[model samples]
Target: MIRTALWALGWALLLGGLLAATALLVLRQVTVLHTWHEYLIAAASFIPMLWVPLLLAALGLVLRLRGRWRLLAATLTLAVTAVTAWPMLPAPERSDSPQLAAEGSLTVLSSNVEYGGADVDVLTRLAGPEVDAIAIQEMTPDFEAFLAEAGLFERFPHRVGTAREDAGGSMLLSRTPLELIDRTEGTAFDNLLATTTLDGTLWHLAVVHTAPPQVGAEAWTADAAAVGAMVAPYTHGNLLLVGDFNAIAQHHTMRQLTADGSLRSLAAYGRGRGEGLWEPTWPVGHRIPPFARIDHALAGREVSGPRPVYETVPGTDHRALMVTVSPSA
Candidate 1:
């Protein structure tokens, strides 16, 4: 009797875990945030890699357990993980076109320093001579002072945008001259629109820091829409947008913004891309590996594109994203 009960319990545990994993993945793909429960679980959208551990366990259990049940479990988990990850796969065929004039290139690094607490030294190192522009969120006077003290300004002297004591501040530091076109306060932060000449082409950039879902789902939706609208007008041009979105590309709000086909996500190098290899970039230095990729770069159609580099800084909860954008030649 006791032995039979133990056997039943093991089966229950295995099946239950598989069910939970499927539910998390499916829910993120389908559910629109309506109720409190739906909104809370929306976080599942950020950590799709949750399937990795489940796949490993299933593979291990197949070797340990006898029977067809083990194979069934393994198969199901693999299929689900594959389907969920399918969108991230690369389709480089999509970026090429003759409309966007081949002119010049610009390299930019965008970062969120976790309330301005990231290591100034590491940031300075990452902000090297090759980068043409730097867009930063959660900027503080102290952080600004540190960057200036580090001699970063001498390398990229043109500075435009805002700075705040709180998480609301944002700024664009550029090697070339920057003309501030407009600025908007995001749901809980700052957004700036500026123009700079990159290799003689008039390039426009919108630096944004959206409200995280922690602020509430509705607010996040509003912020995402605002970002989408901000970029929608330029479907094909020299427009580059970058920032810490606190939301993944697959989320409902995120999809809505990118859906119109103007600005394409530059982070989609799923398998064999450059340094941008599709990966998560948040909650860094937390010991647990990052499972959410809320930081991203989106560019206009003619932008011949971004070779992204994701680098980790010691003190921040987020990794710095460096993208080099060039016109198609």
Candidate 2:
């Protein structure tokens, strides 16, 4: 009886885990859930794609199921795994000769500095002179001074936004002249808007950090949607938006905002090709590996950019995101 009970418990665990993963994947691919709870689930949509297959395979061996039963379990696992991974499959490289630095191109590095505690030397080293812009979220005054002292702010003299000692602060620094566009009012972190000439072409840039969904689903959605609407005008032209969104692309708000096709993310760089394609950007420098991508370098329709390059910085909770944007031919 004890052996039978153990077998039953194993089966239950296997079934439960797979079902939960499936639900999360579905929410990512297509979700109608709107509440904060649902939004939280959607944000975690990628975990299923990552672990379901491996976990199930391990469970199969442990369960010691016989012939047909084992075959059935394997088939079920494969089918579900494929479905979960479909949305993240590669979108194909846009350029064969992707340049690291180019004329008339704007390369930007964005980071959520975790209340100004990110490693100053490391961030400055990674963001060498080739980087055209740097967008910072959670820019406490101390962090601003740190970057300034490091000569980072000097590299891109043109700037917008302000530095506060709280999460609400944001800033954008550029190598060329920048014109200020009003920051979105009434946001946890105001979306900083500005424009600059890149190789003689005007390109709009937005440095954003949306409110975390945990604050409440309604607030998160409103913040996300408002930022999207505020930037709608520039979506069809030379535009760029970057920073920690606190919400992944799968969230209903993000999906709605990006549905117009102007905002494109290079998160699919290595999908299905044996490379680490689903790069996650949050919870870095934590007990668990960073597993969710909540930060981005979103490019506009008339603009193009390479897959975001991520690097871990000491003391920050997010991997810094970098990408270069140019006029698409």
Candidate 3:
């Protein structure tokens, strides 16, 4: 009876692994799985450690199967592993061209201050000298006060957006003069639109913060799509959309934003110093490493040479995403 049970358990594991693999493939191809299926896939992409279950199932089959069946089971396991691992692969090397250097460059820093949870001193220290503009999310009154006390305004004289107690607050600070075009503070998403001149060339910048998906499925989907639509107009020109997106690259919402091929993620641009295609950038407080990269700096096709660098903010749950953008020939 014990031997029979072990064999049955092994078969169950194999069957389950195969089914999960099929589901993942289907999720990738279809867009209608907008509720739990979408959320689960997005969460799995965020915490890839979740793949351990499938791995364990594959191992069980490898141990239980015999002869040719054993070989077939091992192959199936390998396929599952490969498909699951594809999204986490290292990014390709970016081309270094003289033209990219010849064009005017803009350095922008996108950070989530975690509603005064970050160390103000660290932000002040990092923002000066290197950053041309700073896009911040979760800007509370306490955080604004800290920025004032730390003399961040001395470097970034021009500012926009409102400070709120909720996670919806957002602000954009720049050393150069900025012209405010539009601002939105809605229940779904918060955005600030402004334009700044870089070497006499005008470029649009959108500071965005989407509501967390955990709030509700409909809210999450609407928020992501709203932000995408808000920035769609600027894609034809030199634009930089930066903020705590609250969604990963694999999420269907994220895919919808980049579907038009106008806006492209800095990490996914395939030209950066980072090894992996995605850099984890949230939940940085408690000495625990971040598992998902929710913060992003996306550039339009006209923009080039955007190399993203991530830094941990002293007291916040998110790391700052810094990147330099330049014009493309």
Candidate 4:
């Protein structure tokens, strides 16, 4: 009986590990990761917490060798089912934001405009005084024309747009004066960083849009790590990094950004994990949304801020992320 029980335990862990690895691999694909793939990975993360049921089933199997083998299979099946269902379960509600706003030195908005989206009104509506700077991705030619026609270029004196061919572009629009820096092509993605002076402090603002999900797991991880390593040197100063990370806040890829303890997620302070209105942002027209959090705004260690908020936009599939940041002395 003891030997049988030991065998059951080993099998359970092995099966659980395999499922978890498979989920991780699926999540590396941007499209797959955005849709049902993310839900699977979220469910797998709770396997350790789910060991209780597997253990109970193993006990039942120990009673009879043949019966136990069947029981073990049943147990593994149940474990897989439970993990997939975990993300669907509701978590604790997020705390409400304080009604009164704090006096922060800086405020910024980060968004992926879904390549100009369906209309320009959505972009105009999102711009306001509270947002001192705007970081955006997926800028198409139409969107650039809309910005010029709408006169937003005048408001944000300093801006960078990489819409050379209209597919991939990184932009930074600032109310405060900024100095143009070279735009460099990254191995796994495209990036543009510029030096800006805001409230008498000099800062580096890096805008990055990593490789799409089709790149697969190894490429996704490598690209993410490379992006983190590239920005690793700028931990100091008032740094604000923003864009579509294409990964969740809890994923290992995100952890690579914290070298020198400089990078932190704005959602960490926001209420309810800020998963955004419904999960999954790709394929904007899907009827039932795939739940996920793939967009984010991160800051350097010295930077402090109030909680971040996810704002809904009309045209794009993604929700823009906004935050109030305190300036460095």
Candidate 5:
């Protein structure tokens, strides 16, 4: 009876290992999930992709009694974790390309920089002369004073729009002399467009802070459509739309801007080891970027710029996106 029990337990361990492997690996590629189901699956996949490897190793310890099988189970578990959790992990080092810099690509940093409890000293330290233009959100009166003390008011001679204390107030700072063309108020949310001439070529920079996704799906839908309409006409020129878009890159709302054949900056330069593409820029000033890529710096084909720089900026929950553009480039 004792021997029979031992045999049964051994078989059970092997079976569990086989079952976990099959579920985690074989069934992952199935295409039966619908659109909504796919979204749910994507959301669900985000966590387990990190948990499964560790779980597998733990399970392997419980199930494997001997040499070869135990090693196999542990290796498989580690492999799974590496594939899923690697991209989500924090990349502390500077990941920008020197090649792109040598070619004179503009790197634009877009950061929310949370309104309350912001540190201007930290922001200034992070934002070196490498930054060409800054598009900021959540700039309170106090934060404005902070920037002024830091001498951003003088450094960036070209500017546009007032720093409104209200919800629609967004601010833009540029080194190039900029002319504020229009600040479109209340179609859905506030957006501003300014033009600067570089080497006789006119370039339009649209600074936007759209309604948050939590404001309601209908509001976001309308706001996104309006933003699309505003930028659609400028697709032929050197136009760049930058700011806290407050939506994911994959979301339907952001897709509207690229609908006019404009180039998405992140999608263009984001390559290699998943680090380039996983631009999670929220919950700023943290060790690891937040799980959503809400902020963006989008460029059209006519805009001659360098690769987009998504870096942690001073005093905000978002990173500062900086890009340098030249007329001849």
Candidate 6:
């Protein structure tokens, strides 16, 4: 009876591991799994770490099995693991072309300050001479006050957007002069739209903070779609949309935002450290490594050499994404 029970348990473990791996593989490819795909994709970011224990369990089960069962388990487990792990592989080396130079570049930093909870010191440190502009979500009244007290306004003289008490607030600060554009049509969210010329090129900057999907599924979808539509008309020229999107790259809404192929993420450009793709930037306060790239800096083809650097902001749950972009000749 003991031997029979052990055999049954082994089979169950192997089958379960195979199924889980297959499901993740499918989820990585398909974006329309359901309305809950956002949450699932967010969870999928951790699959690289999750697969180790899964592989071990499957290998142990295979060792316990015999003959055809062992062979089948081994084949399925290996195949499934490879499929699920492919997306997380280190990115390839990028070319060292001179077109990617930062001589005529505009450096922008986008961060969610967690409603004034982020450390003022870290925030001030990142808003230095290298950064041409700074876009911040959750820019509450107190956060504005902190910036003012810390003399950040003097550093970045030109500013736009409103400071609210809620997470809907957003602000854009630039060293160059800013011209505020009316972007309040067909939306209830607080997003800032402004244009500034950099190196003789007119660039439109949109600071966005979409509604969290966990709060209201339908609203989150609508808000994301609306933001995409709002920016569609300005796809040409040097355009940038940056902020805490509250959605990862794999989320369907994120794909839709860049569906036109004109606007691509800094991650997509693969111009930063490592593979330069899928760097996580959220939940920093939990004392764990970030596992999703929700904050983003997206631009059109006119923008090139996007280098994204994620930095820790003390007291906040998000890592700041600082991307530098130069005009493509």
Cα RMSDs of all predictions? 5.3, 3.9, 3.8, 7.9, 6.3, 4.1
Off by over 4 Å in 6: 1-9, 36-57, 60-64, 67-104, 184-189, 269-274, 287-289
By TM-score, rank the candidates, best first.
Answer: 2, 3, 6, 1, 5, 4
Give the Cα-based TM-score of candidate 2 against the true structure. Answer: 0.85
Per-residue alpha-carbon lDDT of candidate 1 for residues 1-329, written as tens digits (9 for 90 to 100): 88566566656656765666666666566746422443553556544655554564465455446568767867866885686555444323433232332357778889998778988888888887667899999999988998989998898899887778999888999989999877754467888878899767878888889887777777777777777766666647788888887777667766666677667788764424433344778879887877678898888877756446688887789989888787653
lDDT of 4 by residue, 1-329 (tens): 89777776766655565554445444443323433343444553332233344444444444334565767766765775565444444434656543433444666777787766734566666677667788878887777888889888888877865663454776888998766554544545566777777556677777767765566556666667666766676767777777788766555567556534678876552334533222333435467563556777788877776555666676777777777676554
Scored by Cα lDDT, where does model 5 land? 0.61
Ten residues in sequence with the least summed lDDT for candidate 1: 92-101
Over the stretch 263-315, how does candidate 2's per-residue lDDT look in tens digits?
76656444235433666787897898777788977778888665777888999
* lDDT-superior candidate, 2 or 5: 2
Q: In every candidate, how many clashes are there?
A: 0, 0, 1, 7, 19, 1
TM-scores for candidates 1 onward, in order: 0.82, 0.85, 0.84, 0.67, 0.68, 0.83
The lDDT for every candidate, in the order shown, is: 0.73, 0.76, 0.76, 0.63, 0.61, 0.75
Local accuracy of candidate 6 as per-residue lDDT tens digits, 1-329: 89787877776666776677666666656766524645664555554445754675677577677899889869867975785455556445655333343555778888888887998888898876678899988889999999999999999999999888877788899999999884645444577778998777788889988877666556667778877877777877778888887777766678888887888887763455554545567778786767777888888768775557778888889889777777776
Per-residue accuracy of model 3 over 1-329 as CA lDDT, tens digit each? 88788788887776776566556656655644644644664644534443555766886798688899889979977986886666566545545432233445788888888876788888887785757899988899889988998889888999988788877778999988989887654555468889999778788999988877677767777777777777778888888888887777766777888888898887773463454465678777656666778888888989875558788788788889778888775
- Name the regions of candidate 5 deviating beyond 4 angstroms: 1-82, 89-92, 95-109, 187-189, 267-275, 285-289, 304-307, 325-329
After superposing candidate 1 on the true structure, give the runs of residues whose Cα lies further than 4 Å from its correct spot: 1-6, 34-42, 50-103, 269-278
The prediction achieving the highest TM-score against the true structure is 2
User: What order do you get sorting by lDDT, best first?
Assistant: 2, 3, 6, 1, 4, 5
